[model samples]
Target chain A: MTLEIQNASARAGGREIVHNLDLALAAGEIVAVVGPNGAGKSTLLKLACGLMPLHGGEIRFDGSKIGSLSAGELSRRRALLPQECPMRARFTALELVLMGTAISGQGRPMAERVAIAQDTLDRVGLSSFMERDIMTLSGGERQRVHLARVLAQLEAAARNGAPGCLLLDEPLSAQDMARQRLILQIAKMHAAHGGSVLLVLHDLNWAAACADRIVVMHQGRIQSHGLPRDILTSELLHDVFGIPDGCIHQHCSTGRPFVVPHDLVMPEDINKRETPCILQ
Target chain B: MRAMRVHAGWILLSLLPLLILVMLVAVEVGASGAGIGTLLHAPDVATRNLAWMVIAHIRAPRVVLAAMAGAALGAAGATMQGLFRNPLADPGLIGVSSGAALAASCVIVLGVDMAQSGFLNGWAVPLAGMLGSFLVTLLLYVFATRAGITSVTTVLLAGVAFGAFSGALTGILIFRANDTALRDLTFWTLGSFSGANWERIGLLSPFLVLAGVIATRLAVPLNAMLLGEADAALMGYPVERTKRLAMLGVAASVGPVVAFVGAIGFVGVVVPHLVRLVTGPDHRLVLPGSALLGAILLTAADTIARLVAAPAELPVGIITAALGTPVFVWLLSRIHGADIPS
Candidate 1:
């Protein structure tokens, strides 16, 4: 396994946030973690990346313990993209992307770093934003810019023969449909190029479509884990997510699973008592 | 968008000649009618010799002191703003100046002439000022952060409280000071460069130069920090180390200037923001650009302070604060109205 989490647990604010989660990833594969809100998807990613302290068990990267590696060494092998990055300074997209070379420690010259940043931006479909200020970019564009930065970091790490793992927490939440597809294609390309990806995705359809395997989480525990085609069945959806009936369907041409959620009406009794604030 | 359009490196290079020209003009504008032309070639040997004496002994040290102090404050201001990711994060605004001033005032009020006496081996005043600023900064760090995330509003408010508290203590010291010490205290609080002898300059240059170099080298990490501390750490930066460097740089840079020059205002508050508006917010540009502009701004302000009242001069701090307050107000309104990050 290029990345391994063995019986790990994480706590925040004196509450067990992620309990007894074990997952492993090999090179050249994409794994999507799908779950409802507050299911500890983000917490798991944080714990795995060592951003948060693990309360129990252990995590290893390339057979070395995560606790044993320094932040620089760990960053060289893996990169994480949080859901949102707050930017106050007016760094251009190029300068911001070039910051990915920070941990990799200046082996390449300035020109090479710039070129890699530009190439990564182009791959993420932000070719024209290289000189534009990051603050001027839209929400979706900024997300793609950070995506470019992560890809550039992983690419540089791969050159050193280090394990390359990308951990993204809700990276596509702010992206549009087309940009979401582009981001997925980029993730798949990374996996195809011998990198491992573990991304938290809220949309089950996208997760089912792009992930080689899916791990469904509920209330800080893994509910199910298997091939998407087998695990994303109507019964599993009903049992895990409480979505009943023919809400899930297989595409006629590609045989990929998708969700429609046609019967999403609130129950009459539940609406009177619990739905005081309806989501508009 | 148009405000930050200039290329910072080109702008800095272009401003260098102008800064030198301004400094040359400033050195000649004084009570003594010794101009640079007179210093170079005068009609008589005696006149030329007097001009050389004026240039070498008095004007040169004063100009050098202004430039060095300005550069230190400017770069320190830029570092603070970048570290906090707030446009209003100036060393003066964040209790550094008042803290240092209070420490110096205590030393003076107690009649401890450490520069002459063997109390701290002639290093008591500057060392005390530096220690005071460091402690206040540590207090600020503790008060303004919750769960490793910094709250800019909390920091600003805490700074205001700390400044007020320090001001009250300084007022008590002033009330207790003797007449001779009172005269010194009054001038020091208002700020001046009259103490800019070669010896003081020699004592202060190493600290200023060290701080400037460290701040300039921190450009890359400060840029990362602008993306927020958590994001900077995720990008493989040692965020704690960067924060420590920034805080220490602020103390080392501000303490000596405050100690020697007596709490010059507005330059630290204004220079970095103006430089940012001109250079965009990239620290690679902001840090160096601020240093250059700061040197220019202070030298000009000091020159005005010298010449505006003939033989009697205005305090340079009053000049800077007079010039800086309106611009600061404009900046406040612009940031508030536009919801720009402060």
Candidate 2:
């Protein structure tokens, strides 16, 4: 396993947000975590990235206990893109991306690291936006700039013979349709190159389209984990998400399950109906 | 503007000479009418001695102290803004100046005997100011941070409270002061460079050196921190250490300057903003650039303070506030919704 968390529990704000969770990602695999709000999906991502301390159990990266690794060591092994970056400084996109290589690409020639930053920006379709101030860019464009930053970090780590894992939280939330596919392709490319990807996604259809396996979370616990086809069922939707049946369908070309989400079920209606599952 | 980003290194290079030029002008122009030429080539030995006395003993130390104090406040302001993640954060606004002022006031009122003694004369007030600022910064940090996350709003709001609290204490001290102490107190509150001397320079250098070193080391970490604390840590920086060092640097640097110069305002806030307008927000450029620009601005302002009212000078603080307030108001109006969190 490239990354593993065994019976890990994490606390935030004096409460256990993630309780007794065990998850692992093998090398070259893409796993998607889907859950309702406050289900601890983001907390799990933070735990996996070592940003949040685990209250119990252990996490290991490449068979080494995560606690044993220094911050520099851990960074070379993995990179994280948060749900929203509260950046208001007037750094140019290129300058922001170069910050990724600042630590990971230590001792590398400055020109080469700048080249990597440039290439990553180009990959995110932001080649021309590099000189632009990050604050001036649209929300989606700024998100892509940060995506390029983490990608640059991983690329720099790859030069040192470490295939870095990418932990992303709702990376597609700010992206448009085309850029959403672009980010998925980028994740797939990272996985194809012997790295692992663990992403928290809210759009079940996009998660099904990109993730090799899907994990559903409910109230800080893993409800189920399996292939997309097996996990993205109407029963799971109706039980966990309070969505009615018949909203999920298979895509014709890819055979992946896509959620239409057309039938709006109000909270009052959900309360009036017979409760299918107990929500904690 | 894009060209400025690419050539930020060049801008830093250019600021050095610009600072030297401003320093030279500051050293040349004064109400005493003593120029460098007079010191170098006077008509007689007695005239040259008089010029030497005015320039060497009076103007040089004052100008040097102004520059050093400006550099400290400028760099500390930039570091505070970056650490707090708020562009509007200033040493004056965040209670560092007022905290130091309060300590200095205590030394003036309660420790008058110690201030009169030869051994603890110069060391007492500055040391007390340093301790005061350090305590306030630590308290603010502890109060604003929970679960390793700092709230910018709490930092700013608490700073206002601290400033008010210290101001009231200083006022109480002012009420109990004697005639000699009252003059010193007024100077401390309004800020002046009239007390600048070689001894004060010797006393202030170590603190400035400590601050300069911390500012340079914090550049990259502060850059990463602009993305927020968690993201900075994931990118391999020790975010907690960065925050600690920044606070310590600000306290150490700003405390001595406020004690020595009497709480000069706006140099800390205005200098960094001016530098950012020219070079963008990269702290690598911002820190050193603020230092240089701050030195230039304070030196120039002191010169104007000396000249505008002739022999009787206005306090440098008044001049900085006059120049800085309009720019600050304009900045507030121009700020985008995205720049500050609601």
- Score chain B of each candidate by TM-score: 0.87, 0.90
Docking quality band of candidate 2, CAPRI definitions: acceptable
Each model's number of backbone clashes? 2, 0
lDDT of 1 at B30: 86
Runs in model 1 with CA error above 4 Å? A160-163, A264-280, B1-6, B40-49, B93-95, B112-127, B134-161, B333-336, B339-342
Docking level for model 1: acceptable
Specify the highest-lDDT model's number. Answer: 2
For B1-342, candidate 1 gives per-residue lDDT tens digits of 323455556887887887898788888878888988997879899999999888888898999899888888888888877776666678865567877878878887884666457757545666677677767877887887787655656767888888999999999998999997788788888788887879889988788877877786688888887777777777788777777677778777887788788888777768887876677777777788888899999999999999999798888989999998998898776667553332
In candidate 2, what are the lDDT values of residues A105-203, reduced to their tens digit?
788899999999999999999999988888789999999999999989888878736468899999999989999999999999989888999999999
TM-score per candidate, chains pooled: 0.90, 0.91
Instruction: Give Cα-based local distance difference scores for all models.
Output: 0.81, 0.85
Of candidate 1 chain A, the 10-residue stretch with the lowest lDDT total is: A271-280
B202-224 in candidate 2: lDDT tens per residue?
A: 98899888888888789999989
